[model samples]
Target: MASNGVEKVGVLIVGSGPTGLGAATRLNQLGHPNWLLVDKEADAGGLACTDVTPEGFLFDMGGHVIFSHYQYFDDLLDTAVGQGDAAWNTLERVSYVWLKDRWVAYPFQNNISALDKEDQIKCLAGVVDAKVANAVAQGKPKNFDEWIMRVMGPGIADLFMRPYNFKVWAVPTTMMQCDWLGERVATVDVDRAIANVINNKEDAGWGPNAVFRFPLEGGTGGIWKKVAKLLPPERQRYGCQLAGLDKDKQVATFADGRQVAYDALISTIPLDITLRWLGQSEWADGLQHSSSHIIGFGIRGRCPHGLKCWLYFPEDNCPFYRVTVFSHYAKKNCPADGTKLPTLCKADGSGPDSSEAAEGPYWSLMFEVSESNYKPVAQQPTKLGGSAVAAQGTWPAVVAETLAGALATQLMQPGDEVVSVYHRRLEHGYPTPSLGRDGVLKQALPWLRKHNIWSRGRFGSYKYEVANQDHSLMLGVECVDNILFGTQELTLEHPNIVNPRKNLEMKYTREPVMPGLLASAKPMSAQEN
Candidate 1:
């Protein structure tokens, strides 16, 4: 502990992501001013951060689309970016699946026309069987696999859901639970699927996020970077990593050797990391997570494919689950017109066998792959000393595999020139809905609360249902409401309850938005006995 004699804050937040910022914003709105927020990164926006290549192409960590279920979330974003069309580019989602060597309209389950006659027959048979079983069954599915089999049947499951989900989750469908599937997974309409296959018709306009907006200037990271600016600067800390926490002392130690004590600590760090910080070895030992490798490639010329977004690789030719036409989000994401650049290498890291500079207009794509103990990523060689082109290794065999898969799926031509590349491995990417996750959280949350610590966020609470940007922001806002007043944090305890339009009336407007007038204004620490 520092020699400041127990300096206290009403609340201390451990992350600057949407959730943490939401809490801070709500506390500020309520006028309970004694609080502080910290993040490990140099700026705000956790997974939402955007990266820029040397060639001037911009890509988000992953493709993130904006769709809000909460008015408060909408209000906060609008306030951050200003309520104008100039800050955003709204486009209808043009997404598809590269299956059977062709483009199939999205919600792969509904686009059987894209598959061959045999695959179509298998899928319809399974769908019919699942419908019959569901109509007769009176109990719930035992696991995610069973739920998928019961709803989509073995044929569709074998074709799309099983393989695609395994690629995304880095775990077999049997290992996951079924409860998190609400609204996230699209259920196949048996009649429509069969009709489309019969008539060789492509199904269109399916699922959520049919249309979404992207930030025009700063990329996805710009949104949160802007939101962080709205908060009182004195209360926010960036680039300070939490080294440890003393629950009994109500203190959090930073990597820089500074210590801060608080009446309550709201942590948005990964729960396992939080446990290790608190020295709860036993609890931390039980938590597990899958890592993710995000790869971005900048290429010259207009997009070879007309599709805006699509899912690829059901045959395991590569490691990625999805690839996005990142350049489609914004032209500024690439170089300005007439600028020339050469193809450095092939997607597999192979070259033209000559040291040459290529030239001009460029486009980019982003891909995400999951990794874990069950699905280990192969290693790849690296050139010494940061050379743009060097001898390659196979540790990231997935990289080469992905390159091959992209070509096999027709995402890129065999000779497509790769101008710029970006790759990063995130330790905790998607929160897995494992069999023991909910139980671990159930025990861990109350245990932490006994020490005045509130762990919440995508990995904070480990709930995937409410883990998107809108839900995440609301989680923080609601947590503040609970801490400052006695308001319920609906997004935290009940995800489905808060999923659809909870408080649209509170959305941001030109007038300064504040929480409810009756919301408590007294600082929690000041009032604590």
Candidate 2:
């Protein structure tokens, strides 16, 4: 505590998710002792947390896979948890698109050979038109829709790109900007695509997460929980809801009347909310975000999906845009085969044959439904006529809808016994890359930094392209380095440079000698530490 009767630290970190944890980890490793980490939740891992049902089924907040682009991030994971085969499960990505009532190999544009002959011709014709147009193209695309047409043409745009993106973002593609998309969306390679079509082959190997690792014991949240454990317990404070931030005084007041004064602050709170707190609410209008409704079902059956990880849904047959066979990630994700649980309802939303608990050779599916102003969701009422609604009486309408959708998509059979159900609504699910996002960020981030505040995370900086776990963590790590040594924040500034290639410059023990020195810095030798 400071002499002025306010708690004080060299740095005060808000939100103990990957961003805060990364900042804390780097500070601790650098022997910096005067920093404190706080989070509103009782546990860490903000959007990356996991929830376990009463029947012991585990579902992550959303589909999360680790496809790291930095060696420093890999080092942190290895340091937090063991790197051996026992600690992790390296799985091949067997992802597909649920289209025309059939499973098409992922990167739909490249796998048009699976489509009907007439549809395949449409796709091929569009690709030919797109290539011809590109040879003498004009200025850059006006928006995301234009970018799509420029890259893959109208056939794919109408069939998959437009509809699929609208379902995922809950907004029209015209409202989105194209600059944020570098390697995020797969573009067609005309020659290869044509060759594959002629050969009647599938091109399933496209994205960065084609091969990724997951923690064997815990869900995605378990990884962050382990990372938090690496930090000193005394340095982390939970249940500290931030009430106000005084930029002038460099002090943060909690909801409970506690105050923490700091020389610098690293905030992972959503940028819109942060702007509201700073009395700059008007600037928040430039940012657009979509809320997520995640629904999970634990079923009693052998895994029917086999090695399939996730499937995309673009049609209106399902409310969700994506569903993942979450149990396929780890054996511990589902309850033991002998564990018993009752069936809440059938896949068709009908009553089960028996209400009695049954044993499960279990599997689980998690679905993500996007919601925005353009797409509103039907939420169950908390109270009506001054009385609280019963859980059974007021079942979430979305859950029932999702059950029907699962059947419609053939994800669940007619009478598959559902053992457990989980649904969570994340208000700030995805930070959308809207047309005006960059303009707002350019002004707001620098203005906050002038007040000794560094806002960088998934929702913090609002860059969806670099909002993965590894990218989020590195944002914090880079922000800390910028504060301490005036180093360039490549991840924050030039996402294009840091994203497409592996960054091996910053190892765990290696320390930079000067500011603006990344490429010149050498990794510390094995015996240095």
lDDT of each: 0.77, 0.85
Say which candidate scores most in lDDT: 2
How high is the lDDT of residue 504 in model 1? 29
Positional deviation of residue 3's Cα in model 2 after best superposition, in angstroms: 2.8
TM per model?
0.91, 0.94
Q: Encode model 2's per-residue lDDT on 1-529: one tens digit a residue.
A: 8887899899889988889888887787676769999999999899999999888999998999887777677778877777879799999999999999999999899999999988898998999899899778999998999999888998888999999999999999999999998778888999988998899998997877888999998888899999898887999999999999999999999999999999999999999998999999878988999999998988889989889999999999989999999999999999998987777666655566776788889999999999999998877742211223232233467777787899898999988877777889999999999999999999999999999999989999999988999889988888887878787777888888766633323223334322222333232222212
What C-alpha lDDT, on a 0 to 100 scale, does residue 458 get in candidate 2? 96
